[model samples]
Target: MKTGLPFRRPRPLWFVALLTTFVLVLPAPAQTGQLAPGVRGLATRAPKNMKIDGDLAEFKDAFCTPVEYFSFDAKTLRNRAVQFFYLWDDEAFYAGLRTLDEAPANFADDNHLWEGDAVEWYFDTRQDENFRSQAWPTNANPGAVHCYWTGLKGTNIQGRFCLRPGYLNAIPKIMIEVGARRTRRGMEVEFKLPWANFPDFKPKLNEVIALDAELCYSDGGPRIFRTFAYGSPLSVQQPANLGKIQLVEKLAPSLWKACGPVITPVRCDTAWTQNSRPQITGYMAIPPNHAEQIGVIWRNGHVTGDLRSGVPARRRAVAERPGRARHVSFVRHCL
Candidate 1:
């Protein structure tokens, strides 16, 4: 059942560095175009527990918005039948896309994604009141973040978090907590972008920000792109073209039960060898770990060795090292 190492090496360094908690950036107002009446933040009352896995059950209660683009059928081709959902908490904003593709293939390693299929999400954190002043984005509003994730042939998957001036790139600058899972129909993608990642993003009640996204699908060649906004107006280069995201106030925490995976980091020794999968035991309830298993994993693909002994029931292996070890523990349905 396992998908054999989830690709070859660890993601690019730009990505691994973003795994930690984000630091909030200062707020600066930027321009947001006229929001489509339907294109507003879909309220998520409680921070619903979700994983990047291609599971739709978690999204049953979330909002499902339609996409403007789908495929290519020449004269008869209608909407592609793509849906997007939105969620936000104190820390970050979450979005998921359920795309229906008849023939899903062609996933490239680098940003040559246009050659095949890719999903694009553009954000303009500035929301500057004077956004109309600039011809396009400049260093003045550098907090804008453009992100995209890919499931290569439904087997290998990764994300590119662009923080610098560029939007589309062959390689990403940093990585965030992004996940993608392949489904029978096509592929379900999930990603989280923290407010802290933006230099000018400030979280506030009913706070409106610029946001837009789309999905690009291809059978083997050519490209068919879909957008959340009309005419696919939002682009990394044009912040003013992006739609808006209004922060919807949710009920108090007492209203709902806390759901999702509860994760904790544990340390381990480096006795394990490289390429050797560690055995984690002790806890009566074993939670599902991430595919990109932490520790002993590096670009060089080196680890000490296989784990000979299991950690205590509650204690989980966080990471492995040539001479050191650590473990991360999580409980499913913790709510």
Candidate 2:
């Protein structure tokens, strides 16, 4: 089943203006590459009249990714399931999480919020280069984002960086719009992350990124357990290990014909890197169904590549050989 629909082109912020106006140093968007399974999901465009009130009403019809993996201490938490939602608009990336919990509370403030009942989210705006990275966060060329959101702040919704105290001070302030609603059954957390924070990234059609949402449960004493939608031990090692999701137009149930991924890399022919054999890659997006039946195709300055454990490792031919596309690894924020 296929349908034709018209979509609007994303408006660019011309982030280049920052380079000339403020002489700000922005980390270049990680070089991307094509990998089929690497993309765990697709985020359809938000409705024109969308609201971020933390209610699940707007997402009533959207498909949800479940958070099934839990920590050893939380093995009995099978009853406490979680559902994650994703949406993208021209200006930002939006995420939502809903879970069953008798006690949803977060007493910790600022950097210590992880100790309370909260959702510690991680995002990899960079494509294959840092998609499922296992490295620690760095200021020089930061590729992943780590943060915590909790609405139990009592006063209002709050979010904070989970990075080292001053690790992200140098970067521009990231304004995230977050909200949460407590229900008789559980709670819902939602947030909108603007592309402006990622000055180098201009959200285009089918632009993909890696992300995940981890649900932390405290129930008063302390964060007793945790669960992951796209589980990766992201505490400090895995940022790129988050799940892969791309921006798309109207998400239809059955669409055989659709737009392909748009993989764009920061042009850098010569790089002065600390590691050897560093590779340049391009990324492309495909419909979930066709991902398994991928056919060779080429785009400008990009080649279809492969992913091992979410990291793009080696290169493939321009248009030859039929093989399975390796899946990418899979996080979220809130208040």
Q: Which candidate is the best by TM-score?
A: 2
Position 237, candidate 2: lDDT: 61
What is the C-alpha lDDT profile of model 1 across 104-218, one tens digit per residue? 5545545455445666666665656743222344443365655555555433555433333353331223335656666655566777666666646677665666666667666
RMSD of 1: 20.5
Query: Quick one: how many clashes does candidate 1 have?
Result: 31
Over all chains combined, what TM-score does candidate 2 have? 0.58
RMSD (Å) of each candidate, 1 decimal: 20.5, 17.4
- The CA lDDT at 289 in model 1 is 20
Q: Who wins the lDDT comparison?
A: 2
Per-residue C-alpha lDDT of model 2 across residues 33-117, encoded as one tens digit per residue: 2334556666767776667777766664343454432212343442255666777887878887776666676777677777876
